[model samples]
Target chain A: MTISRVAIIGLGLIGGSIGLAVREMLPGVATTGWDADAAVRRRAAERGLAGTICETAGDAVREAELVILCVPVGAMNAAAEAIAADLVPGTIVSDVGSSKRRVGEALAKTLPGAVVIPAHPVAGTENSGPDAGFPELFRHRWCIVTPDHTAPPAAVEALTQFWEGLGATVEIMDPAHHDLVLAVTSHIPHLIAYTIVGTASDLEDVTRGEVIKYSAGGFRDFTRIAASNPTMWRDVFLSNRDAVLEVLGRFTEDLSLLQRAIRDGDGETLFDLFERTRAIRRSIIEEGQDDARPDFGRTDH
Target chain B: MTISRVAIIGLGLIGGSIGLAVREMLPGVATTGWDADAAVRRRAAERGLAGTICETAGDAVREAELVILCVPVGAMNAAAEAIAADLVPGTIVSDVGSSKRRVGEALAKTLPGAVVIPAHPVAGTENSGPDAGFPELFRHRWCIVTPDHTAPPAAVEALTQFWEGLGATVEIMDPAHHDLVLAVTSHIPHLIAYTIVGTASDLEDVTRGEVIKYSAGGFRDFTRIAASNPTMWRDVFLSNRDAVLEVLGRFTEDLSLLQRAIRDGDGETLFDLFERTRAIRRSIIEEGQDDARPDFGRTDH
Candidate 1:
């Protein structure tokens, strides 16, 4: 039931990192990879991202005991479809998508006979593509698996062990709950960052040059989040529409209250909210979820 | 005249850092400091935040050639008033407030007889209070000085030199322009962060523990900003009401556009805006305003 031969369907940051991690951490596991873009395939080959670089998705998954789709959420169905016919009768299918419910449903529909267990490793930098990945990207990060309740227990156990072997703490979560949680923690934060960065750039009173110069005051943090792969984010917003919109609604409502407070000169309300949020940051650092340094310990300056 | 005797009122992060900086960078220039809280004055004395930790604000400013007020924006007037009677006739008065127009006006009204200038060092960590003082905090940072055109050239030159000695690049800016620029750069970003963190914490569907656990996905950055001194931020929003409100209006408009795009599945618009903000981040890095490292090079974990 152990996963020994793996196929990575998209050699971007997540796929490339998984290939590298398997090579480094699970040296006995045989890894093969494929990318939709020929240029990325060439780059992945140059980096030796996998033991074998297959020309097509079907060829990559033919011998793989576990096939992981690492493409964007919008392309999940196509990637699953490409490998659906090639995957052997016992092959287990999985993916590294942000939104779990949609990706799980897509994989289940496209490859009805395969064991489909969707996973999302809550780890990444603001970089993508083959060159942007490293073996250590998933170390000490969370990997959430949303397997169908009816899926084979051995397949679920094997997938959890696979992620654990690559240095992640595995958690089993309901697909719908996973989407809702990620919507708050990841999706809404990114939307707010993208929105604010756009807002700063479009200001008529403040020059873009000045905004860049004084960004250390706080705006630079938002810029980093906003700089993430546009294609990936656009697909994320489109795929996880409901959860994102629901969270965004809450964010907008809270923002309106603060706006009213500011306009009314309600210092107590502002102070109370600002003070309350500090505890969350402290808890994050305490739980080893974030770096506990001043200014994220940005000493590269 | 060169500033040999400097007095810093309200010995918090900025004031204490300035005292420590003067001691490290300009040993010959003696520094006297005062804080309203007795515990803080004791801590400053223990840390040797200044050459002389004065018992009163008047005692700190008496016979000083240069005096800098470092307090919350709402408390600027009171901090200035504390030293008005004791200031020597030729002393140059300045402050380290976030909003220039309001601070400059406050200092001018409180100490009309003395030369009043307002300056804002565009640098700080989330940490505050006496223990947060560090001599190198201002290294390679920007310090905006908004001085009255009617002020003597010698005094202005001395103030600029003082900031430069502390390892800051001094920029002479108009008070109104400084307010608008900071509104976009610092104030609005903080406001949005505060609002979002508040929203996330109050979500009834998601457990607070889940939010803290997955914060590294992007929520952690906002939490750090939202953790800033609540009293200081509340005062900043209240004092810079007009500029913050104007910037908030623009931010809301931009966010609305993004909301519509998400609703309509306008991927191209999201991609374009996301791509545009990346350039700003690159410019900030190229200009040495922020760290070029991935994820702010946060290695404290």
Candidate 2:
């Protein structure tokens, strides 16, 4: 890869996974990582999340050729500012934030003259933190790289090669489109899962104990998604407000149609929609984006 | 177990699973199964899903002490009618339907004087049909038995023992309460998943191919659930319309709050709700209702 040194800010799941992945995949590339939380830095250091778990963000980025801000979308600007003074000229700055348009704009504004090529690796477990990361987390997963007008071709190419080295297939998309696509694929799903989980827990008739006990029906799958990091998701919604709201509106409209069908006992409408949705699942499995085994091949089953 | 011959009408996932579980757990108990679809019956026979894959519903339940209807809730009356004449007096009739109230009422109406105890095993994969069953499907899963006033205590005890024999924990609940609980735990979740999957596929700006490609970002999980049997889910919504609609209304209200929070950048509300949902996930894992591993411990991951 063209990039020789990498600096990763935020030692949580995404940042830690990237550090470990780089260690395993691109041994020649040196990595330095930092997290604002001291305890996390200690864990990252113990886990060897990077070649050097630096004490400060500036220290981590001082000699790096590529600096990837792996903090929450809401924290992207602050994280960028932390390393802006330390970043050398010609360094390509990027982020692993879910929302690209805002993150791209934030990084560009913070690091005035630096190359900012934002990217989001569309993969994660519900679990977060230093311990939750593994080197293979990105294997066979798509990493969408959203580059704006300021990013040079060479920088984007180098970043793509860096991700490919970690076993991710890179897709180049516009910042606006990335925000919209992920608003549908990731943001709305998380929002709905979180909302349903909250609703189920707050129900007066159905006890939370009962909901938890009988969750194997379908609720448990949602619980898994809803268990995702709060700060990260909270930032995602705030950062990608427009796209999330637009998609959420569409989802609400679609949901209303299904709700009316149920109310009217329109079995045909329900069955047709259910059947059509199944085709998408089949396509996802065929594309190797999900487990084909029943119930995600959960070991307990 | 007190019962000897066990009849399973409709050799699909649930029916076939009970048959296989019987063969694996209760070696002495005889099982006779019949499916409306001739193809499913053939597959059940090949898989040895039951001790005897009977040619007709009447033949299956002719000598059975317990007959469990495993057809869709919408088909319960027809399936019950098919075997009603052959059911001996004092035989206990039950069903593996998502909605209990309607199923309990239908079973009672179709087979007058027969002991009808409806039960719903809150367990399944996104798969259906004869090939999608296994002996261990019910292990560590909850089987909620809804017994009405007409159901004898002895019959309920025997049914509970049968499910226990298959390695399921039995919870006896009132039929109406059972519908409400399942509406929140099962029906509403399925409705939302189906709706979201349909929404994602139907999005004009976001191509279906792109959604499938980047689905690992939470959308794929919903797809797994949305891929559930169309007929079964349709029947569930139609039969449990009241409870499903009720829970769905609550879910919509909750979703609206989150949508508004996102629009208004109310991160605290989002963060607080997200944090609370994580506890439910932990409780589910502690209860052994779900896999504790990240990403449901999918083999590919």
- Residue-level lDDT for B276 in candidate 1: 82
Question: lDDT: which candidate is best?
Answer: 2
Question: Candidate 1, which segments miss by more than 4 Å at Cα?
Answer: none
Off by over 4 Å in 2: none
Residue B177, candidate 2: Cα error in Å is: 0.5
lDDT of 1 by residue, A1-301 (tens): 8888999999999999999999999998999999999999999999999999999999999999899999988889988878877888768999988898888887888898888999999988888888988888888889999988878899999999999999988999999999999999999899989888888888887899899878878888898888888888888998888899899988888888888999999999999998898988889888988888778888743
Lowest-sum lDDT 10-residue window in model 2 chain B: B292-301
Instruction: Give per-residue CA lDDT, model 1, range B195-246, as digits (tens).
Output: 8888889989899998987777888889988888888999999999999999
True contacts kept of each: 0.78, 0.91
DockQ of each: 0.79, 0.89
Question: For candidate 2, lDDT tens digit of each residue in B1-301?
Answer: 3988999999888998999999989998999999999998899999999999999999999899999999988999999889988889889999899998888877888899689999988889899999988899999998999998867899999999999999999999998999999999888889999999989988899998999888999999999889999999999999999999999999999999988888888999999999999999999999888889999988665
Per-prediction TM-score of chain B?
Answer: 0.99, 0.98
